[model samples]
Target: MKITVDRDACISSGICALDAPTLFDQDDEGVVLLRTDRPAAEDEQLARDAALACPASVITVTEVE
Candidate 1:
């Protein structure tokens, strides 16, 4: 699975960090940053939860399979 973050829609809610700190973080401007390598399969469910929890709907989770 691959994760895409819509920076424009992100409001720095930090939900992603809460769900998948290994895959997402906030920049100095409080914008969500996507890991270049994306999230691993083990973290797919949490990542999707984080994305869905985002009030801005900025996180997009795509399944490669």
Candidate 2:
């Protein structure tokens, strides 16, 4: 799966980081930083949850064939 974050739309709520710390993090300015756009199979669920937990709806999780 591929995770995509729209930095412009991020509200810095930190939900992504909280939901998937291994796959997401915050910058010094509190902006969402993607630790890995392409997550491993085991981490895909957490990545999706993080995407869903974003209040700003800026996180996107796409399934790659």
Candidate 3:
């Protein structure tokens, strides 16, 4: 699986950071930023949680096309 983030819509709510700190962090402007491209499979759940936590729906996850 792959994870992506859309910066324009991000508001840096820190939900993603709270949900998946290893995969995301709150930037100075308070936006979710991916720290790594390929996170562990075990962290996938947290990543998904983070994605869902975004009010702006800027996070994207894809396992296939």
TM-score of each predicted structure versus truth:
0.87, 0.94, 0.87
Q: Which lDDT value does model 1 have at 16? A: 83
Better of 1 and 2 by TM-score: 2
Model 3 Cα RMSD, 1 decimal: 1.6
- Misplaced by over 4 Å in model 1 are none
Write model 3 residue lDDT over 1-65, tens digit each, in one string. 68899988897778888888899887788977888766788988887887788888988877643
Which of the two, 1 or 2, has more lDDT? 2
Instruction: Give the per-residue lDDT of model 2 (tens digit) for 1-65.
Output: 88899998889999889888999999988999999999989999998888777899999999988
Q: How far does residue 45 in candidate 3 sit from its true spot (Å)?
A: 0.8
Best by TM-score: 2
**CA lDDT, candidate 3, residue 61:** 78
Weakest ten-residue segment in model 1 by summed lDDT:
35-44
- RMSD each, Å: 1.3, 0.7, 1.6
lDDT of 1 by residue, 1-65 (tens): 88888898788888888778888889998899987446666888888898889989998888787
Candidate 3: residue 48 lDDT (0-100) = 80
